[model samples]
Target: MAMTQTQRFGIFAALALVMAATRIHHSTLHHFDALPDASWGVFFLAGFWLRGAARWAFPLLMAEAVLIDYVVITHLGIDFWSHYCVSAGYWFLIPSYGALWLGGSWLAKHQVGLRLSTLALAVVALLVSESLCYLISNGSFYWISANVPAPRSFAAWFENLGDWYLPFLQTTALYVGLGAVLHVLAVQVARLAQHRGQTQH
Candidate 1:
């Protein structure tokens, strides 16, 4: 069944909000929060669900993220993005996040797969999108950083790449994958209900 735009946004936005709540308590990479963030999933789902309006999806999602992080810091007492380093290269998130939406939109445009085949396509898209996001977000921030010491070695600064990147991938994959499963289940249930109603008539 075809989903209305409102419903599509509702499902993805709800998931992003709920899953991100877990991260808000201690969401930063340094915090070691085990719960996966729905951030990537939000953009991915936006690309898949937003249909033709993907141009505005990144900004919208970015706004939502900023608002959530502010609330997390002020209300929940978390330290994510606490320093001024964020402002130096933060706008790069526009492209980084847009990569995610672009990936998912590509999948939808290709019509990827309705069966389990979507898993492969989704993973490929996920990897490309997240990898770029990580590079842009981290690289730009680190290089432009006013907090880190001067004359830092690339090896020293980039040493934490694996530590941060791996978990980020894990979290993003966990939420996006689970969200996809839930979406499929929802469609199945709806079809079943419609089938039942038809039989009753």
Candidate 2:
């Protein structure tokens, strides 16, 4: 059965807020940390969790992200945008995130699940989706608007991909996989309780 809108929003809204808090406290440095930003995972889950009008959750979460950045830059006196928002490439996030949403949506459309085959298919879809998102996002920034040195080459861009893309995939997988596990556990617990109550009757 299709998921209800409230259930979808409840899951995503809580996750989005938590991730936004981490993003808020995040520094400009590139060092990895225990609470690496969860936007990538959050959006991936959004596509998985939301369908129909509930898909509106994407833009809502996007807005929350923007608001987080706004508070960080304006209220907190951080120049986050200046560092990355130097060109038209920044706006490509719409399509980048769209690809993420599409990835999860495609998984649901095909009835992918927790099993090995479905999980494998999901990984492939996620890889393709995130790869495309990375290309558009990093590619636009590097080739279009970024202040890359004159005479940029594929070698240099590949280095950037190394810095950003793999970490993104890893961070997203870590969190989303954990969430999937918890979800399965909760379903099992609920089912077990139901069985116990029925036996008692």
- Per-candidate Cα lDDT values, in order, are 0.71, 0.73
Best by TM-score: 2
Worst 10 residues of 2 by lDDT: 23-32
> How good is model 1 by TM-score?
0.80
Among these predictions, the greatest lDDT belongs to: 2
Q: Single out the weakest 10-residue window by summed lDDT for candidate 1.
A: 26-35
Deviation (Å) of 143 in candidate 1: 1.0
Candidate 1 Cα lDDT to native: 0.71
Task: Point out where model 1 deviates above 4 Å.
Answer: 27-30, 74-85, 193-201
Q: For each candidate, C-alpha RMSD in Å?
A: 3.2, 2.6
Backbone N/Cα/C clashes per model: 0, 0
